[model samples]
Every structure is written in C-alpha cells, then in structure tokens.
Target: MSTTIEYVRFESTDPTELAAHRDGLVSLLRERYGADFLGAHLARSEDGSFLDFLLWTSPEAAARAAREMPGDPGAAGFFGLIGEVHDMRHAEVLHSTQV
Candidate 1:
C-alpha cells in the first residue's frame, strides 16, 4: 500500500521575506523528496495569504519530515507567519489504477 500525505497551511501576513524564504525551501524539498514529491503552490492575493500542498511517499515519512524540516535561515521565520501549524492529513491507497 502506498500512502499519500497532504497539508494546507495559512499565513496571516504575507511578507515578501516569507515568500522568498518559502520559495527557497520548496526548491530544497524537490531535491529531498524527488520522485515521491508532488507540488501544489497557490497564492490568492498580494497580502500574502496562501496555501501549499505536497504528496509524500508515505504518511509516516511526510509527518517525520515536517517535524524535522531542515533547519536553515530561510526556515527560521516560517512558523512566525501562522499562529498555528496544523498537522498534515494523509490517506492510504491500496490500488491507484491510472487508466
């Protein structure tokens, strides 16, 4: 069984600094997650409210990665954007026949 994990996060203040930080961070994720990664980036307005989605190889791995996100200067200010960071939701697909 393959597990797919998804997450939705909201930011109150969309500072350009935050945008720059996340942009760099996502690029790093590509290198790390690779083939198991699925990217969905959304920006609703200029004020900086946005949502990002990701699909991971396994729900467990996703959860772990989120917790242990690479600590870098760009990541340092990430949590400041939101008053709360919700836990990522996930599901298991026994058979995903793509046809």
Candidate 2:
C-alpha cells in the first residue's frame, strides 16, 4: 500500500478567516481526491500558527489529487492569508497492524 503525509503550516492576519477558507479548501479536496482515502487535521501551533496534517491512501492518489486541485474559483489569496508552507512526504507501507 502507498502512504502519503503532509505537514502544512498556515498563518494569517485573521484566524477566523483562515479557518473558514480552510473549510472550503477541505471541501474541495474531499470532492476531487476520491473516496475512502482522504484525511486531514488542523491544529494551533505553540506560536499560534496553524498546523495541518493531510493524509491520503496512496502516493499516487496524493499526486493525482495535487494535479487535480480545484482552481481558485474566485478564492484568490485564500491560502496566502492563512498558510505559507505545505510540507509533504510520500512512502510505501512496509508494515502495518492497524488501518
């Protein structure tokens, strides 16, 4: 099985706005990324920055999702207002006891 993980960092002048935009972004991802394989997390960092973890079922699925990300759709600068970096990693499952 393939596994992918991303650590995303987002910061914005307005945390509430960022949270709202993030909700929209997640919705878009859920629609395009396929079923039974998409997951995400959002947390407030010690520095008050937002940390996001997005997990997918496979590396290929992650890449495909990346390529298929929805267009701005008038949501310009959404991420810039909330996040800066999206750190990502891809790997294969060598072993696993739980899903």
Candidate 3:
C-alpha cells in the first residue's frame, strides 16, 4: 500500500507550549496506530504559523486517525493549544527516499 502524508497548517499563540505537546502526541499516535503511524514532523514558518506532518502507511490509516483523533481524550491537550487551523489534508506519496 502507498503511504499517505497528512499535513495540518495552523497558527498557535504559544509555539513553545504547542511544541511541548509533540512527544505526547506522537506517543499517543504510536500507541493507537502502531506501525501504521509511520512518523510525524512539526515545523514553524517565518510568518509564525506552524505546519504538522503525519505519515501513515495508507490513506485509510490516515483517514481513520483523522476521524478518531479528535474524540481521543489523550489528544485534548495538544488540540487545545491550536488557535486556528488553516488547512488539513492528506496526499499520496508518489516517491520518497532516504540518503
């Protein structure tokens, strides 16, 4: 199955607090999704917004997480820190490489 890249772009009032939740969020995803949850990355833009990327084994897995994560009690703290979500979407990875 092809991998899916889920990206969420948002603005947060407190980047530090939002960053602090990274490990917890990742742990929760790993616990819930296991190997299907490949990895995650968080980046800050020059405009002060943030971009979050989550890699999943498939689109189904990505969609499942999107459907379930919001209702997950463990994600509340991380979700609460986001002031606004500009965009969220998933794209199929055509190619990837490690060097």
Strongest candidate by lDDT: 3
Alpha carbon lDDT at 8, candidate 3: 95
Candidate that beats the other on lDDT, 1 or 3, i.e. the better one: 3
lDDT of 3 by residue, 36-55 (tens): 99999999999999999999
- TM-scores for candidates 1 onward, in order: 0.60, 0.67, 0.96
Task: Compose the digit string of candidate 1's lDDT tens values, residues 17-79.
Answer: 666677666776777667666654545445445555666777776766676663544556664
Clashing pairs for predicted structure model 1, backbone only: 14-48
Per-model C-alpha RMSD: 4.3, 3.4, 0.8
Top candidate when judged by TM-score against the true structure: 3
Q: After superposing candidate 3 on the true structure, give the runs of residues whose Cα lies further than 4 Å from its correct spot.
A: none
Sliding window of 10 residues with minimal summed lDDT for model 2: 68-77
TM-score for candidate 2: 0.67
| Model 2 / residue 74 / CA error / Å | 6.5
**Which consecutive 10 residues in model 1 have the weakest lDDT in total?**
79-88
Q: Provide backbone clash counts, one per model.
A: 1, 2, 0
Ranking of models by TM-score: 3, 2, 1
Residue 18 of model 1: what lDDT? 63
